[model samples]
Target: MAGTQSYVDDLSGTLDERLIISSTPQRSNALSNKFSGVLSASYADSEIRDALHSLDENEIKNTAETRRRLRLNVQKQVIQRNGAVVQEYGHVAEQLKRIGAIINSLTACCEVMRQHVTAARHENAPVLEEASSLLVQKQELETKKQLLDAFNKHFIMSEEDLLVLTGATEAVDDTFFGVLMRVKQIYVDCQVLLGTENQRLGLELMDQSSRNLNIGYQKLYRWIQKEFKTLNLESPQISSIIRRALRALAERPTLFQSCLDLFAETREHILTDAFYSALTGSSSGDNQNPVTKAIEFYAHEPLRYVGDMLAWTHSAAVSEREALESLFISDGDEISKGFKAGRQAEPWSAGDDEAFDGRKALGELVNRNLAGVARALRQRIEQVLQNHEDAVLLYKIANLVIFYRVTFIKLLGPDSSMLETLSSLVQSALRQFQTVVSDNASAIQAEIAAPTPDLRIPAFLDEALAQFTTLLKTYDSSLTAASSSVADFKSIISQALNPFLATCEKMAKETNEPSAGIFMTNCLIAAKTTLSAYDFVQDRVSELNEQLASLTSSLVEYQHAFFLHTSGLHPLLAALAPTEDTPGSLLNISTLPPFQLQPLTDAGQTLDDFLPSALMDAMENLKRLGNTKLSQEITADAAERFCEDFEFVEGKLTAADELREIALREGGEENEKEEQELVPLRSLFPRTSGEIRVLLS
Candidate 1:
């Protein structure tokens, strides 16, 4: 596999907080369902402890060589530090030796005490002898020790040059509490030996220098986080530790991100509490608990309050505040998204037509997969009703409209009784429609009209319905909505009127200039007959559709019963039974066995095989019943053949008759002369045969 890498960068942008940029993802190890580390354990968490642990044993192991090296480095860092300490301490020891040597011969026991005193001075440590040991030695040197008020105090800013080289920093203390006050002598010695400073000042400078390493910790952590992503691991702790360090150091971007993350928890807590309380009839003010208060402060407080406190940890108010936030915030859950979708109404309908526009919101709702709404933002406001295939949106609309009507009417006061009546009637009317609208017209209308009239609805109902519509545009639309059914009636009337129009146009085109000779009375009768025929054909199509619908219902019931009866069918085939019979026939539908259609794509079942059983049965039965008609259709073809043959025979007869006349004429005078030889000119003029001869010799 190709190795992967990433760089996460935080850069200041239009927003105040620096934005972290994640490098484009590269192919990685498959995503693992590893549980994320939430840092429930202490000791600065998995990543921090892990990183600290990861330093090589040799790195952590402070051997004598390490200490020697660090001592050398410290010596190099402070000018004349080791030399000054060594020289200064040596002078004090020599002076103490001279004083002790002078008193040494005073007594044998005194000489031994002098030797012990000299040895203690030579070692650079403070000569803190236990009281018992001092007493034993003091008795021995009672006279000759010259009443040493305090053991000569000598300090050494001594440098052990090879300490760092021997890994002195990594040496584990053999006892507890070794890391704090019991620090390396080299660090202490370097502090004393360099420049002018007391012990307290030296400690302060050390503390100041150590904080710079924390910045490194933060940088290194982030670097590791990016690498983890490139490597395609589960939620790793490395990035979080990096963030934690930044937060600890009050890095602005990390601090804000930490707050933002905590905000989610706080928001959820508050919302959950509120939602629960809404059901429980508790007030929003019930957030008196420390946790609840923190959550509320985080969620609802002005941004400035959080900003100041987050800058530092000593800000007790913020610490308490953050602690409280971590306790109980919850992001709100979406119970319902009041999306409005309406039915496709007739073009002429005066009420409302189904339409939706999401050009802006389209980017949102389509992405959401109808899983209600996203928790991050309000579901969003769509200007038009949403149109989806779900029939529930329609029923939901009717229910909603009922709510609006009653609510608005009650808001209008005692006179609003009419609103209640209308609301109920409207709901009842909706239940009776043959075409079930699968959209949200009622939601759209109610959202638009609810606020305009302040009628008395049930207070609970009023609040709820109001809350539901809170996101709708505040401005009322200028368009006037008509409530009457005339528009719908007009659509019906058009359906009634089209056939007459088609007839008129066809007739107008066909009219030859009938000579004004045709009587007006007869023309009127024909006109009336044509109009009647057009009207009849229009009604016939409607009747046919109604009959098909009726048949569809029966077929549905039959198919349902059939599948129920064939319960013993293979489990796969049982699911293939007829369902949702539409008015049109699918008797010729072709399909593979439903079993073969697994993992479906755009391919639809062919019309021949996928026919619903009811439709197939209905088709076969219809064919069996129409056998007589089928027979008639067969003879109809024969009738066309007979007509063609008859026309041919008639043409031959006419040709034969003409040929006889032409042949006799062509025989010339021979055939005619035998009969006409005895005929006089006037006798030849007899024209009963429809022939006349005219000749001049």
Candidate 2:
């Protein structure tokens, strides 16, 4: 077996050599065939084995040497590659060092350049700024020069043009009077042009024009003073001429009238366009009434016309005062003559009549102007109140009235008849406000009365009270102005609430229901609470509180009495304790034995009939009254007392039953004795024989 195995191993080795040689292209085909032939040679088994052993030892030795040589070669190649890498890294390090030096040099140069640039900027900044400033100044000077030239070309006028424009002969005339006349004419022309321009231009532009004209007016005024001094004019003549000049220049009657007309038209437009349209929520094309328009105008813009009107009225008043003082001083005889002639019903002289007529004309002017305004304002107020029921609007109207009152007083002087007219209007409005308050109070009272005896608080009560509080606050100023008005308001409220209190009191007295009194108490408490919510009721708060307390106390008493009456104790107690003049009394028991038993039996019987029903009703009533512990205790006590009395009366009847039973058992022998024994019992019980028999059975 060893020999066969050896041979198989030799064959396998030969085949393996052939496969390896076949895979190698570099091996010669002759060498591969020679190895195959050697393997396949016919040789003894031992010889082949020996050859195989030698070949194995040689192959192992060659494989070990080849592996050692390959390891040496790999180590040499690794060392060479590591040396090359180290050399390349040194070169890269050297290049980086040089590049870093270059970067540092560039940084230093940039720093020096930045420092120089900063120095240059600092050195040039002021010169650049100065040059810019000079250029701006030069531009400004050029602009001003252009504006001056334009102004000169446009506004500077020659003497002839000035004369033509101002209706003056010459601005610098030879004579002082002529110069004064020229200046006056110039002032007059400026005033006329200003008025014309004011009407055509807007308010801002007109303001500018007025400023320019004011300078001219000042010059004219100064020139007049100079001319008056030069001419050596008297004070009276200077005053007269100056007054004429000022009147002619400043008080342009036609222009003033035109301004008034414009004011009226503007007021009308505002009323129609803005105020009435917003107030009534309707377009006021043409159908709106003059009264409504006037009201809305005042309501919306109460101060719109006040300033202008006051100015005009003040000017007119000053003029009137001057004229009147002059007339009184200069024409006193003429006025006296006119008055005398009028008293005699004869025509006055021309001077007297003319003076009287002038006074009349001025008076008419003031009166008619103020009357129209006052009448229109009063009608507007009426229309406002009629159209709207706002208490706040009433206050607004009152405020407007006060403003007008003060304004008109100032305008017409407090003693003018116009003040009386305004006072009447204010009074009328106050009366209307009072009426509204009274009406509202009446309405609230009616609401309070409408609920049944149950007095369920009306749902509208809260809303009504809220409205009342608002109304009071709105008119608090007016109401507090006079104690009388406050009193009147209090009276109205009392009148309104009185009926409610009276009704409650009447119901409380008439009804046996405790709920009636409770309802009344609640109503009074509610009324008090509602009234207390209002601050304007401060004056009446104490009085109202007292009234509420009294009413509540009375209602409480009624409630307690009704509670007692429901239990039937009130009537029973009244009967038991009769007064001196009353005959029937339970205390009279000893004087009449017969009547004593009758009273007890009658009282017991009445209680039996009513106690149960009263107890049930009382239970229900107390339950309705909130089921308080006191009510429960009262009911229990009443029931216990009634039951005890019933049981006592039953026991007395039972004793009488036993007595009759004994008498019947003894027959005629014990009858007389039993009768004598029963005498007192009979008086106490008052029972008949049949009743006794029935009771005994």
Candidate 2 lDDT tens digits, 628-687? 553455455544444443344444445544645554557777577665654343344343
The list of candidate 2 runs beyond 4 A from truth reads 1-372, 390-396, 399-413, 416-422, 430-454, 459-464, 478-485, 488-521, 532-550, 566-568, 579-697
RMSD of each: 43.4, 29.2
Question: How many backbone clashes does every candidate have?
Answer: 59, 0
Angstrom error of the Cα, residue 145, model 2: value is 64
- Each candidate's TM vs. the true structure? 0.17, 0.35
Cα lDDT tens digits for candidate 1, 1-697:
0111000011113111311232235422332111112213344567745544533322433444644585565457466777899999999999999989876756778878999988877773444556667887878788545433321111211133123122224222222112221233224443663566555655654553233223332333343333323421123222333333223222222322344344334444444444333223454676444333342234332222222122211122123233322122111011001111101111232243322222222212122211111121111101011222223332333334444444433333333333434344344434422122211323322333221111212232223223222211111111112332234223322322222223232332332211110111122222233233332233434543454344333433433343223321223223333422321212111122332233111112221122234233323322322233422332333323323332332233233334444545678878675434322211211111111001100
The list of candidate 1 runs beyond 4 A from truth reads: 1-255, 273-657, 663-697
Candidate number achieving the greatest lDDT relative to the actual structure: 2
**lDDT scores of the candidates, listed in order:** 0.31, 0.49
